[model samples]
Target: MHLFSENLAVEIATYYRNVALGHSVVPKVFTLVNGSGSQYLFFIDDLQMERADEDQFLAYIVQEHDAVSYSRGTLVIVEKNQQYIEFAVVDEDDSEAIVCSAELTRDMDDKPIGLSEFEKILVKRESIVFGHLYDPVKLSEEKIEDFESLWEEMKPKILHRTMGV
Candidate 1:
């Protein structure tokens, strides 16, 4: 099945936006297919991250989601007491997965655009799969150092799972 549909993304975003109002953090929505033939739309706020211990976090997720089924074209909302809400669809399998996200933003440029200008904008917003994308507003070097440290802490754990070491 196609991973992303623009219309679907907009609808999902809108629905979550209402439910997520007044939350401390911008809610994150993730569409994932598990090892089983199940698909899920997970919406979680970062605030929950602050209070959850490792075991509580694991338990919360495990108990909240289990193998379930949904109609092919129906969107089901799950009301669970946890960090985020979930919508589930099952009976589909995925060997590989890719993610796409979209946000409507006002164009900041105040100048007329020709072909060259348009190409520049596209390049600026282009997604980079393996490395950081171009950012007009650069982060401070100190901030970069802090981010690098955080990445280092998780890098080995990720590599161990992804590389099967």
Candidate 2:
């Protein structure tokens, strides 16, 4: 998370900032996929409870990401609807944050990756990145292994506990 983003600053401020106290806001959705083409969705809507715990978990995960991350930063998980996950980086002192998204996407040929399609033209895309190791969103062998192990650790704690196997 060294090159972390500040893209979600506006959203955090508009929805989560408190003038007197610190600020906290759920940015958007984030998604995950199990090996067998099943999906798990996670997010914090207006109704969800234990916001602090969820946010803490997200920050921990991002910090513990097998890849090299920052020394003193965390990815606050705000929401997750599908494979596309949105994380918020918030600044309580300044009400600023960066948006990080992990999505299941397709190539130019237009075919779905990981998750099986529900219909003919639905969520179809194969290449997904939990952590963009470098620009252009390509991952190496070590990074892939890191992702797998991380997924294993995260399986049970995830919000939507669904297994496709």
Candidate 3:
């Protein structure tokens, strides 16, 4: 996993849009799971999480998204089709965000994705260049149990909205 570039992110969104063309509904939120490993990304809408730190962190977000605001959040992009889950935690300060943390579940016999040494090197480089970090760690079963909890909570709401029920 490596940090997501703006172009790459747009490509991903385009990929999904193409996939949904005349086949599936275009989901308002984006959730892409890296089947080869526990790496995935999802979009957050109407977020309600409490701010644990400074109130101004996400203060710049506006109805219309811009390039500068786009870089405000963390970005992680995984290479094609590997058993990995990738997560990017958005923060006001890129350094303050955990550039490389949160490991995806690995398949048996699959080489681990995020190595501390490798991550250290990447993090160091990214820190210097203001590049994003995309390191995926291995997690205990219990730790990642709630990874899809957001989707679970939203499923019903999405269904209702989509179905007009």
Candidate 4:
């Protein structure tokens, strides 16, 4: 997973808050997603709606993150979800702290209300997608084998890119 340092997350949150307040876009929640599927969520103290734009906002995020090398993998944006309050693990010990106010529901049990309902719910939510790169690490033989099997099914296109393929 592409993990971000705590300092990095705080810096991003501060930047968005400053920009949003200055531009009168008062954003409620901020989120960042790295190419590796790691996510960061930030809750806004006071939110407004005028400053949300995918490209400009992402540009700011990339610049702040010094993520130019992995520009394709870093995404930054804000979200406004009414029902749920999203947050991040600030202190490793306090993973329940409210960091942001929006999140992705990965549980099948909490599936979206319905197509039409989902659309209405998403109207206030904004997102940005980007790419990021991370260092490679070695895995155990069993893990490698498992990854290979999963990759074969989920990312067959990557096979040809592997060394000695």
What is the model-wide C-alpha lDDT for candidate 2?
Answer: 0.33
Candidate that beats the other on lDDT, 3 or 4, i.e. the better one? 4
Number of the top-ranking candidate, with TM-score as the measure:
1
Name the better of 1 and 4 by TM-score.
1
Whole-model lDDT values for every prediction? 0.29, 0.33, 0.29, 0.31
lDDT of 3 by residue, 1-165 (tens): 323332324434443334333333222232221212222233343345544211121221211112121222222337433322222223223443222222222335443333111121123324422222222334455533443454456555432111010
How many clashing residue pairs appear in each of the predictions shown? 0, 17, 13, 18
Candidate 3, residue 49: Cα displacement in angstroms equals 0.9
How well is each residue in 87-141 modelled by candidate 1, as lDDT tens digits?
2222222222222222222123411111110000111111222111111224467
Model 4 vs. true fold: TM = 0.23
Off by over 4 Å in 4: 1-5, 35-165
Q: TM-scores of all models?
A: 0.26, 0.24, 0.23, 0.23
Residue runs of model 1 more than 4 Å from their true location after superposition:
1-26, 30-43, 50-64, 68-92, 106-165
- lDDT by residue for model 2 (72-157), tens: 11223343323332333422222222443333333444332332221111111112122221123334667556555655765675
lDDT of 1 at 133: 12
